[model samples]
Target chain A: MMAGSALRRLMAEYKQLTVNPPEGIIAGPINEDNFFEWEAFITGPEGTCFEGGIFPAKLVFPPDYPLSPPKMQFLCEMFHPNIYADGRVCISILHAPGDDPMGYETSAERWSPVQSVEKILLSVVSMLAEPNDESGANVDAAKMWREDREQFNKIAEEIVRKTLDLPPP
Target chain B: MADDASSSSGITGNTVENSINQDELIMKQQREIEKEISETIPLVGEIEELQTLEKEYNEDPIYLLKVKDLSSKYKSIRRTRPDGNCFFRAFSYAYLERLLTDKQEYDKFYEIAKNSKDILVALGFSQFTVEDFYETFMEVIQRVGEHAGSTPDLIETVRMELHDKFNKQGYSDYIVVYLRLITSGQLQTDQEFYQNFIEGPRTVTEFCRQEVEPMYKESDHIHIIALSNALKVCVRVKYMDRGEGSQVIAHDFPEGSTPLVHLLYRPGHYDILYA
Candidate 1:
């Protein structure tokens, strides 16, 4: 019964996303048969180290959809402060308030029914542009980002190239 | 020594995996606790005599006194699940139950509820999502209103139906979500006025996103005030606490209006009260 409502909302959101695809994000259900799983491709923000790359991610929504936030993970390798080594994204908007695995600031945007798939992807695009170092899912990447900008940019560029199936420069 | 050893090992290979597993474990336990509560308690329980509260507070003189004072004014209580959505659930259930008998108030509420979707959309809420909740909310309201002007027996039957719908998880939570949306809409529409109530640097919209919109987030004074003003309904909450008083303090939402809904506030929970 709960999954029924979740599926309906997912279909509606899928249609909305398709009709007015956000500027840098394209997403849809992985299979027409199962709306629970989605695949999205996000373009790296321009003027950033991740520029010119197409990053793929997977969103696995629970039976309670909008009520609870979906689990988002990058399909390709990511070396961001907020993206875990295993590719799971750790932004605040992906978590409900007080769930606090990462201890996000109180003012950070949280996962609520009003937030849509489009909003999550836009936050991801901005996350790629400016990584928040405080809640580092990838400690090594966060360390590099804080202590050595040049090295961090080099790694980000490699990751960007990797997403595009290009050889490291 | 055991803690030290575990901490040292935690720093070694696969720390990320270990940490993630720990977080998952904590979340799993939280879910289990919630499940236990849900199994033991109904979303909204059947009405019970106010004396039932006395048994729970019999040993404590302060609470016992407060319960006695509460009973003087209110005869019965309808308890809601103490899950964080209790305030919204209890308030809506009590108000709709009242609407079952009051056709005039029902009409007023029905019109406000019917027009709420457009207000939310105008406030930048997505029509797609708001539409589903609005539809369900209207259906429930319409069902309860169907027997509003009928015989006493028919009204009783509709009242049972209202109880059944409130106990159902999907319908009940959807109503709560819709009310939360309306509350959010109210806060945003009067941002300048609401902004003064918020602490720190967060704007009205930010406060709504974090505190008001999320499911399972508890409601506060600001929430009650906004919701009451938005719906044009007044709520009188009788605050019962251990603080230095035998009398349960009654505070109306808008301070001066007659309260159509009476609720008993006990620390973190709210329950419907009947006079």
Candidate 2:
């Protein structure tokens, strides 16, 4: 029953998105029949290693939505401190709702039903500019970032090149 | 005449008193039952009504809003129900299906769904693929509507077949293989071509490159970790946080960051990155 209602809500949001698009974010239907599954393109935030690079990703929504957040992963290989090798992202807003059980995060930082795609994309942009390395998903990447800033920049540049379909340096 | 009058009067009084007592007992019992019904009926009705609304307007947005209003109205009622919290999850699937089926007309549906962390994790499960969508649809109309189980194996089998093809292509990326299978239909020119294209490796690749490649490119290390973290956060936030141990440690780093160092902060302890 709620699923039907949530679906309708999603549809209404989709209608509005088509008419007015946000900057640095472009996304649409993955297929004609499925709205829950979409392909998205996010340009690397300006003045970042990912700048001018078009990154592709996927967003898959569950049947029982709004009560849950969508899972998004980049199809492109990226090197970042917060992302795991498996193509998963780690943003605070994407965290599940409520207090962190592990005593690692406060309740205020977790995900809520009110969080939107615009917010998520904006968070991603922020994530690129400044990653939260306190609890690292890609521990190695995080370590390298904290210990060796120069090497980290080189690796990131390689990723940017690859993302742009350029050969490795 | 005096003896007959006394006996008849006493007998009449006793019978009337007994009849009155019985009537009072019956009325009391009826009132209790009525009270119980009044309290429980609304909650059950809300659940039923929500389910009915889903069946009636599975794809209609306007009607769905009415259902949402009803949900809000009876928030307390649902809180009392055992599986009331599952409503968001249940609705997300229906909402997702609607969005997928009528993408052009219902783009906003995806946006709404994207808000829920739990829903996102469920959708990421391999079971919610496009092939499963078809299978689910057919099963619903098969006249034997057994709507109480997890996804059937038929769809999984197809995914397995597609996995074999991926191995042959020398592509080790699991996400790539998964996307190719789900979005296979988008590659076809018509409905007739969908079946053949989805099942065949050559066509699936062609379709994947055109449709899946661009999005795949955006999935950088940052996105991957964020996604994985989101999944964990959803589990922790939705399920574990309610448990005894509910703490999460999150660390963030800049892009192009590498994890290759050992930190020594204690007298004899150092944190080293494990390969």
Candidate 3:
């Protein structure tokens, strides 16, 4: 019964995303038959260390989609403060209130019924541009980001190049 | 020294893993408790005599006194699930149920509810999602409004229909969700005024996103005030707490309007009261 409404909302969001696709972001169901599992490709924000890279992530929505936030994880290799070593994205917007495993700030935007796929993807893009080291999912990456700017940028650039199948510079 | 460093790193990894596991375990237990509550209690229980409340507080003299005072003013109570959306759920249920007999009020509310979608959309809400919730909310309202002015027997049947629909998780939750959106829209529209009520540096919109909009986030006086103001429906909440009073304190939302809906508020939950 819950799936019925979740499917309808997912389809509506899918149509909205297609008709007016956000810049550098494309997302839809992986299989048209399954609205719960979506594949999203987000272009790294320009002028950031992740620039020029296209990152693909999977969003597995719960049966109560929109009520509960979807679980998002990158399919490719990712090295960022907020991205777990296994590529799971850990951001505030993907968690409901009081379900904070990362102890996100209270002011951070959270998952509400009004929040949509477009909003989550946009937040992800901004998260890539500026990682919040305070709630770091990758401690090593966060420490490097704080103490070794050059080394962090080099690793980010390598990941970016690897995303494009280019030889590491 | 090298062996010590490697062992220390391993222990750190183990600690992280253990903490993650503990968090997951706590979350799982919470879900289990929620599931038990859902299975045992209806989303909105049937109306019961106000005296039933006394049974729960048998050992406590203060609560018994307060319940006695409440029973004097209210004859019955209809409980809503203790889920965070109880305020919205109980308010909407009580209001709509009251509207069943009052055709005039139902018509007026119908117009307001009908036009609420546009208000939300104009306030920068995504039309696609808001419309879905609005449609479901309207459908339920229309269903309940159908038997207005009918015979007593028919009205009873319609009441049963209302009860059945409320029991269904889909319809009940959608109603809560739509009311929440309306509350959110109202807060954003009157951001300057509501901003003072919010603690910390969070803006009105930020508070709405974090507190008002999310499901399972408990409501406070701010929420009650915003929702009551938005719907133009007066609400009187009788706070039943362990404060040093024999009588339950009554505070009306918006401070001074005739209350069309009465609710019993206990710390974190709200239930409907019928006089």
Model 2, chain B only, scores a TM-score of: 0.16
**Model 1, position A80: C-alpha lDDT score:** 93
Could you tell me the TM-score of candidate 1?
0.94
Tens-place lDDT digits, model 3, residues A1-169:
6788999999999999999999999999999999999999999999999999999999999997877889999999999999999899999999887677645777888888899999999999999999998775888898898999899999999999999999989
lDDT of candidate 1 over B104-207, digit per residue (tens) = 99999989999999999998898988977888899999998898867899999999999999998888989999999999999999999999999988899989
Single out the weakest 10-residue window by summed lDDT for candidate 1 chain A.
Answer: A97-106
Give the runs in model 3 whose Cα sits over 4 Å from its true position. B1-39
TM-score of chain A of each: 0.97, 0.88, 0.98
Would you estimate the TM-scores of all the predictions?
0.94, 0.39, 0.93
> Model 2, B20-74: lDDT tens per residue?
5466567667655754653452211221233443465678665555445444433
Q: State model 1's lDDT.
A: 0.91
Candidate achieving higher TM-score, 2 or 3:
3
Two-chain DockQ for each candidate model: 0.55, 0.01, 0.66
Q: What is candidate 1's CA lDDT for residue B179?
A: 98
In model 3, pairs of residues that clash are: none
After superposing candidate 1 on the true structure, give the runs of residues whose Cα lies further than 4 Å from its correct spot. Answer: B2-35
Deviation (Å) of A156 in candidate 2:
1.1
> Rounded to one decimal, what is candidate 1's iRMSD?
2.4
